[model samples]
Target: MFSKDVVRYHHGHDHDHDHCHEHTHTRGAEVENKDEKTLKILLLHWVNHNETHEEGFREWVEKAREIGKEETASHIEKAIEYMQKANEMLIEAKKHM
Candidate 1:
């Protein structure tokens, strides 16, 4: 499963996690769209956030390859591609705004 899914599952049902601060993104559209300015800010934020994950996933891909997990590495590569596509779409949306 994806990291976000694991995060949501852990945080949504279990309250024993170490983190305390609220994640505003989890609230979705209602919380994100206060105005166009706020939405633009969130778009930039999400793009940066996804880039961080993509970097980490790339690192894990190398680690997986080292451990002879080529299949896992390939899957992570695919995930990186998806993240890039998402970022492109986000950038395009920002352009239109």
Candidate 2:
């Protein structure tokens, strides 16, 4: 049994936090602009890929720091830049779609 206040609290907000909920319910656009659905799917996939790459890069940087490896730190920095580029590309693609 749930309290009334609890139910009210859950339903009271009209904030943009509902975007996630809306996103789940909404279907992709039907019109084709370079195959919009496919492009959106690929962009989303690349976003995840870039995120994982960034995470791994961060982990590698942390491990290098722990080992006091300055040379490896520089290499990790370069890798981070590349990951950031990939992330930015994915973000731009999503915006266009």
Candidate 3:
């Protein structure tokens, strides 16, 4: 569950872009630009969320192997590896930010 302190902030760009960005703002003062700050928050959230999902996937992998689904389990393990790689990139991005 998301914390009550975090609130969703929908902000529209004044540029010619046709799409609007939806960002989350925690209850506090922000010195950074809105878009960059929200992006950093989102990246952290995604990393944590991915960790939870990876744990669930590992549990399923064990169950799959127990039921004689070795191939399926292998695929899920590969997916977990890919997710780790993606998270590494996200972390790097946040570092640059």
For model 3, the superposed segments whose C-alpha errors exceed 4 Å read 1-32
All candidates' TM-scores?
0.66, 0.56, 0.69
For 1-97, candidate 3 gives per-residue lDDT tens digits of 2233433335421212122254546644442566666687778877886787799899999999999999999999999999999999999989999
Off by over 4 Å in 2: 1-34
Comparing 1 with 3 on lDDT, the higher-scoring candidate is 3
Name the TM-score of candidate 2: 0.56
- Model 1, 39-90: lDDT tens per residue? 6766887798778778889999999999999999999999999999999999
Question: Candidate 1 overall Cα lDDT vs. reference?
Answer: 0.73
Candidate number achieving the greatest lDDT relative to the actual structure? 3
- Report the alpha-carbon TM-score of model 1 versus the true structure: 0.66
lDDT of each: 0.73, 0.64, 0.75
Model 1: weakest 10-residue lDDT segment is 1-10
- Candidate of highest TM-score: 3
